[model samples]
Target: MNLLNTLKICVIAFLFTSLLNTTTQAQITPVLTHDDALKMILASKKHAELSDVLVNIAIVDAGANLKAFIRMDDSYLGSIDVAIKKAKTARYFNIDTGKLGELTQPGGIIYNIEHSNGGLITFPGGVPIKNKNGKIIGAIGVSGGTIEQDKSIALAGAKSLLN
Candidate 1:
């Protein structure tokens, strides 16, 4: 009878501990809200305006899902898909697209990788947005501008999360 009671107590303790751990893990996983994505898009637009360049901006969650997007007046229609691809590339790889571009060059480790994944923009315009814990929560991409301008604008958007 004592053994039975002890076994029951152990089982109950194990269940309680497992439940607590699951809750704690859920709380620690960061989720990027829609408002956060909007803030990033707006900030990127502001930066693009300052540069006198029209752009298409896109934000994607950590799962490479599009959350928000905008195309500035006079921006190229072709850039719409590019912007989304960049954001997805950054989020999927958890790395900036600029660096990914370099790594995908001829003789590089990931050469020809861009041709896969249905199409990816391995250029300087996508950046991952990481939480305070250094975990990537999402990414922002900018297009319809020079690579330099696109990169600058995307950086602005990614930095919005710091605030």
Candidate 2:
């Protein structure tokens, strides 16, 4: 009788531990989906059209992997890589590239930091996408126009995820 009781308690504890682990895993945050990434690119394209600025847009997941990209007709070819770098930079740093640029000025604390991380685009146009809990899930980067224009378009893309 004593052996049976011990065995039963052990099984119950094992089941409880498994249940707790499952619940914890379920609470993990989800990454950006393809649908959300496409929506972001579309929003950025619309903004670029309205501003009459040809641009390249890139979106990366939480892991900084490219998920979606678009180059407007006549957009500069060089901007394709720039857009990707910007998105990666934003995700890696969890901050807008524009702000990062400021921090990398000659006399700034992170001077020349852009030379790191396989080359980062520390200028404007890279924005981190955050969830309702204020956690960053991805990033968007826009290039090909002026810095201001790129930043504007990128902001539009990032904001779309909020809605």
Candidate 3:
């Protein structure tokens, strides 16, 4: 009789614990929306003279879905697609595509994944956005400016999230 009672209690405890685990796992990470992406790009325009270089900025969710994309007036036509690829690369690989190139080197494990995905760019202007727990939930990409300028804009966008 005691053994049966103990078994029943253990089973109940196990079921309760399983439910708690499921609940925790289902909690979605806070992700940036389309509005947030646009605000970041528009707000950063004042940081420097964007006249010479029209900027293209894009943001993608963790699943690599395009949340938003913006191209400044006079920006190059290709900048939009480039920015989207950059964002996809960052979000898919869970790291800045710029860093991936170096970290993966020729014949390296990550190197193999460089272009396998649908749309991924390894250029310098892409960056990943992480939550407080250090989990990447999205990415941002910037183009239309010089590589350095684009990188700066991407960094600024990420920093804007922090603030």
Residue 126 accuracy (lDDT) in model 1: 92
lDDT of 3 by residue, 64-159 (tens): 888887777787899889998888888887877778767567777676565577646776898887754467878888888877888888877777
Worst ten in a row by lDDT for model 3: 43-52
Best by lDDT: 2
What TM-score would every model get versus the actual structure? 0.81, 0.81, 0.71
Error of 1 at 58 (Å): 0.3
Clashing pairs in 2: none
Please report how far candidate 2 places residue 21 from its true position, in Å.
Answer: 18
Which tens-of-lDDT digit does each residue in 48-146 have in candidate 2? 999999999999999999999999999999999999999999999999999999989989999999888799999999999886557899999999999
What are the lDDT figures for the candidates, one per model? 0.91, 0.92, 0.76
List clash counts for every candidate, in order: 0, 0, 0
Judged by lDDT against the true structure, how good is candidate 2?
0.92
Error of 2 at 130 (Å): 0.9
